[model samples]
Target: MRTAVELSWRLLRGGGRRSMVGSLLTLAAVAVSTGLLLFAVGANHAFLQRAHADAWRHPGDSVANPTAIEALSTDYVQGEPVTIIDLAALNGDAPVPPGMSRFPEPGEVWTSPALAHLMKDLPADQLAKRFPSPSGTLGRDALVHPGELVAVIGRTAGDPATTARRDVVEHLGATGGPSRIDRFETDASWSADVYLLLAGLASVLMVVPLLVFGGAAARLTVARRDSRLAALRLVGATPGQVVAITTAEAVLTAAAGALAGLVLYAASVPLLTHITIAGGGWFAGDLWPGPPLLAGVLAAVPLLVGASAVIGLRRVVVSPLGVARRETPPGMRAVRILALAAVVIAFGVAGGGLIDMGRAGMIVLMVFLVLAFLAINFAGPWVVALIGRLTAATARRPARLLAGRRLVDDPRSAWRTVAGVALTGFVAGFLALLNAGPSSGGPPDELRVAVPYERSAAVAGQAEKRLAGIDANVSVKRTETRDDPLDADGPVTTTGVVTVTAPGGTAAVDRARTALTGLVPGKVVTTGADEDVTGDRLLADLRTGALTVLVVSFLIAITSAGITSASAVLDRRQAYAMLRLAGTPLSVLDRARRQETLIPLVVMGGGSLLTGLFFGLPFAQGFGFSGLIGLAAFVVLGFGGILGAGALSRPLLRSVTADPAPRPD
Candidate 1:
């Protein structure tokens, strides 16, 4: 056992550049996978924490109305009733006062501190005249006024009882404006944010399977080293001992990978933070760092290492016969189906959630994702047949015949490669879809009318009138911004615009431009204060998230696929030699190799891609699937690239074949 372990170590450490290359590739996969998972999980946690803080503190100090009035500037007549929250909602165990509405109306109240500052500009006796006192104060005075920025309620301004709602007040600061006359009491759902954290982690964790299982291809090197392992077996090495030694090597390799991954993860975090912080539209809160986050990092190491070791041992056996002959894993079809089934269950769960919740956009996205994944695996035969027929139609003569024959020659390998290419395609397609979808709702068309903000009632009205003048068929969709806050520079105002139906030829309406007209001086500005911007950083994380997964997993797959296919070809060297001696052309033999590899490559790649899309759909829809057609186009291109790679045959028998000329013995 000691001897075998020593031999394994020596071989691992001493082998030339090829050995080093293989080891590095293995290490790279582990590092990338681990690092990605860590970054994604960490960033998600950090982002969520920041989101909560930002929403509670500075900007979320006021209320936004999505439906009733778009902006306070538009709603504020020269004289109208106003409400200001005197103090923020207090958390206490003591009994509360009654008769005061649990929430307050916008422009109907003011905080004493805020009023004191504003009253700095007015005489003390005149302060009460300009701003009347409200009925109740949690502990302080509520000042009622007309069209003035006063007490900021941190809850929705539409609610009547939030005399001091924290959410309304924070929103008031965010919008850069005065508090409004009407704000609704509402809570933002954080489900999507939670899902982002979990989903991003899962996405990163998926790399584990690819790295562990994919590295199984390297076990072919063990086959080459069979005589060495057998020699140890002959000497006092037990089967268990041999297995232990091999597994230990796998452990060492994976450990190195995990460590590297951790280092990469830790090192990159600050940089990621910098980028996110600099962008700073909304996520301007302190980073999340605590025991839970540290625990998450620690947990990933053993999980990755143990998984890798298990996969390595699955490649070789404890017995001496393990190294004697090449053995393909058993019941591939059932295994593939089982794997597919698990993915299907995941998709069903996600889709079912979306459906039950009546989230139409999410449901639609998930449905397409499910279809894209299933298309790669179950549709392999059909895909081959279709491609074969298509290629046959373009065949000049012999090339066409060869292309058609490839469908039957090694369909599985061909499809695996195709599946891989398709995964990349699906992501691209999904992005394209997003671009095409409505910026806010339904879909964009000529005369698309939308309320940019729910509270911007005055602006919405003005925009509607402008659109009405253009054409009657113009659409006007009003959305509530009761939860959105105005900027600090302006009065709390809701801003939404109506889409005008041009006479078949006109420019699309600029939402920001329309918002500019109704703002109070030094106050409301267009564009900048939407919930979407608050969530933008999370989406940016996705851009690299997908690429990281793709690159690492694809590399693992490629390495594993190449090694396994090469070894399989080597085991069949005698067969190839005999065929060459016979009348079979070298080209046919080469074609056969390509067929064998291409099938599985297509299958695995395509199936994984389809699975990704299926799982990704509900999430995509939640985000809004707008550029679906573009996503499809990207998928098609990815498929073509994979197919092309699979079809190109390597110089077969170059190393395997012996020279015809005799060598001196």
Candidate 2:
């Protein structure tokens, strides 16, 4: 074991340019992997901490304000939706909301940063009309509007207790559902844990692409290492000893890489502290992983790396004859299609039940996503081989023919170079669905209506009675909106919105609301036209998701492309050098590399989209043809990205072409 360790160390320290380049690649992989893993951990931790802080900010079981609460939700704040929390308790009884330093006194209302931006120069009274008055319009102090920030207001102007109580009882408590004490005395309906889980999910998604890059960097030179080990075996080393030597080398390299990664992670943390997440950026202390966790991660990565190395070498037993000549891998088989088919079928079955999906359903869907990802990976090489055969059969040029044969020769390695973009494209299909949310023919027959939380139940009855007097034929289709906080552990605001859909057009909505205007109290936004509101929302989500994918996948692509180009050239230098001697042009070789990346990119990227659609379309029946547009856009972006990655090998190809042919011997 000592001898094996020493030999491994010596090889690591001095194996010529290939080893030097491979070491750098391996180090880069470890650093990136460590950085990504740590980032995920930090991000997850930060999200939870922020949530917990929010929960603790107003840690009461229920609200205890004396004045009646009239809560409503609206999209009036900075184009992002916000809950307009109205609390009109007498004097000292009005409690502060979370994340705020203090509660606003009688006439003053605290506004969220978003809301404050909109409050510019409006007179106090005009501002009050847009937002709620603290107690009611009677005993008013100077009109003080905090502007466009998220707001907390009294129900009426700064009225005394007697006036405030009468107003609260008159407006929110007309139906007498629950006493004021009963409202704030009970625990909030939802749990904060849900948000944490969501944060974890985001982290998991982010980490997947990072690992893909790291793994590609770490493993690109495996073939050369195997050849070296084969030579060792030719001398007399047993397979077990060879394994020990290789494992030690991997551990040593991985450990150094892990250490370098830790340093990179530490350096990047300050940068993370500046990027806002969940309404606020994290502090350095907030994102720091504890020593034990850091140590554990550092310890675990090497062992995993070592194990993977051993697994990779399973079929690589060294022999004198094998050392002299490499073995040919098996051909792509038709059986590979079953792997993709199984995932698609499983996704379809799961998605069939994913409508209005509950927590369990979401979990099942996420599991299916993971399964689909693995299946795509497993099927990738086979699909590449298929494309290769097709390409080789139809190719009319030497470059195209060479590229096609290369993919057929080593489809798995080729697949690795472009898989990140493929996976990212898979995610784009779902984004397409988001961008094309539930399409109902004309301007989505939905009206978003806000009402006071206290007499919320009464709004329906009142609307019915009033609408009956005007037109009984006008039906209201309402969707119940539960006031789940924006995220788990987010502040609890009782404000909610109910969607009232009138399929009978804008005129029907006017007719229906004309009667309810006298009875149902609160704000109603017209949604039958100017439907970009939904587009704005879905587009925002899409942009955010796309940005994350683009950054991570691009990183993976560049890293993998660089490493793969070097590794490929190293593997075929003798042949390439001879071809150079025989007068093959550099441009032809360059085109070959371009085709190698472009062909699989088109194939794998399309396959990813198809797989994503196979599952997504089942859930996207509510989405219209616009979803197709999103899918098209995603495929185009992926194709552009892969081409960009292929272009990265230009310098390497130039250098390879420049080298003179070696002696034929």
Candidate 3:
């Protein structure tokens, strides 16, 4: 073992420029994979933390001998959601909330830092007047994210704001009315759950591609490594010694790369904090994956690299003579294609609602989607080989002929070059078709407030009186239901909606809402535009997350293409040298390399994109103009990115083919 380790170190350090370049490429690949994996894991953790931070607003359970009463309402200021928590203590023993040092006194208000800033910027009547001057700021533990706007107002036990008569149930078990509670913690809201699901989905999308890229790192310069290892076997080195040497080399390199990846993740934290999700940007600590997770990833990456390296050694280990003679391995089997087809069909059935899987149906569908995604990987090399055979059969140009033969020679290597973009194309297609279109809302200037059905006339009179100074001609009418998309319970049927329309513009709407703030007790005074705010925000968030996923995917795709293309040049250096000596032009060689990547890219990328669209069809209501535009844009960008990555390796190809001297291995 000691001798094997020493031999491995000597081989790694003493290998010439080509070997050094190969090692660097592998290190870079592992580093990128490790950093991205950490980011994906961190993002999931951040969403959960955000959910936990805001869970207190949900009010866990109602106690018979409660110490406090809590009422939750939402307010809109400049088109942003501001969660308002109205609280009153029934006894001195009432527990303080997450961010507060002690229970607030009556008339005291606590605001998040974001809300404090917004209050200072807006007019007193427009926003600040809605609450008394903030007496304290809510801490991070009490806020979902750094930019979230939340206000906790302390009220007297009998205050109308906390004791309003709510006829509708907001969530499943709790009425919209204030609830008695002995504690502040509870399960996350439905919105939090939605965010968590999206975050998890995004992680799955990213981590898989990163894993593929990481595995490809082990195969970089495989031709050179195999020849070297084969020579060791022929020199009477046992298979165990050969495995020890390979493991030692791969583990050391992967460990260094993993550490470098941690550094990269740390450096990216400041930039990641700027991305807004769930109505606010992240806190620095929110993006931290913690010490245990970080350690696990560090260990996992090197082990994965080591395992991949060993797995690729079968040919050299089984028959060193065959490797030395440069025999081509058997072609990939059709079973790879079968596995992919099976997964796709299963996904379609599960997602299309063909089977009644109950509440776990969505979970089952997501699992199939992931399987289909991984299956694309399994099928890619076979598709490449098939494309190669056709190209070799029909190619008219030397470049095309060379490209075909290369693909047939090693389909796995060809597949790795375009796998990242192929997966990215799938993500782009899935997200594009899932976009929600613009929602039609009520008249922009109207302010709608839900009031008790019995007191409709009295509330209308009070509303008119409150807005008398703002607009005397303000029309007020009572309706049967509240049309608020943000309301989790859907349209409130039991309550009466008091529609208030003023002659003036948005200013009048804001003033009307302010005037009717507590006129209907616990109910929120929302505008006609507010009817679509929830849907609009959800759509906007979806687009943002989709854009984020596309960007990250493209980065990985481009990086994988560029790195693997360069490594491929290193792997085939001797072949290129011999071809050049035989009078083949460098231009032909470069063109062949580009065609090798482009052919499979066109075939596999299109397949994955179509599969993504197929999976998304069940959820898509219709193809929106924006979705079409996004699809077209990504298609153009994906092809353009692959071309650019291919172009980057042109110089490497030229350099490798610069010398045509025959050298002994």
Candidate number of the best TM-score? 3
The best-first sequence of candidates by TM-score reads 3, 2, 1
The TM-score values for the models, in the order shown, are: 0.52, 0.67, 0.94
lDDT per residue as tens, model 1, 1-665: 56655866787798664455455555655566567556545555654554342222121223343222222211111111122322222222211212134543434443434344544554433234333353333222111111123443333423333221222222322232232323322222243334444344434334333433333423433333454455566577766776666666655666677778778766765555444231232221223346676566545554555454444443344544544443333322434455457656755755646645644644454444445445444555455555555555565655345545554443443443343344444344334312212234222223232344553455545555644433324334554454436545444445455544334221222222232232322132222212233244345444444444444444434434444444444434455566666655766666655644454445444455455555555445443343443344344444444434434324335444444232211
Write down the TM-score for model 2: 0.67
Question: Which tens-of-lDDT digit does each residue in 30-51 have in candidate 2?
Answer: 7777777777777666655555
On residues 204-240, what C-alpha lDDT tens digit does candidate 3 reach at each position?
7788888888888888888899999999999998999
Candidate 3 regions off by >4 Å? 165-177, 354-359, 452-454, 480-496
- Candidate 1, run of 10 with poorest lDDT: 72-81
User: Which residue pairs in candidate 3 have backbone atoms (N, alpha carbon, C) closer than 3 angstroms, thus clashing?
Assistant: none
The 10 consecutive residues of candidate 3 with the worst lDDT sum are: 167-176
Give the alpha-carbon lDDT of every model. Answer: 0.42, 0.58, 0.83
Show model 2 residue runs off by greater than 4 Å: 1-5, 56-201, 259-297, 318-320, 332-334, 393-395, 436-539, 581-584, 621-637, 656-665
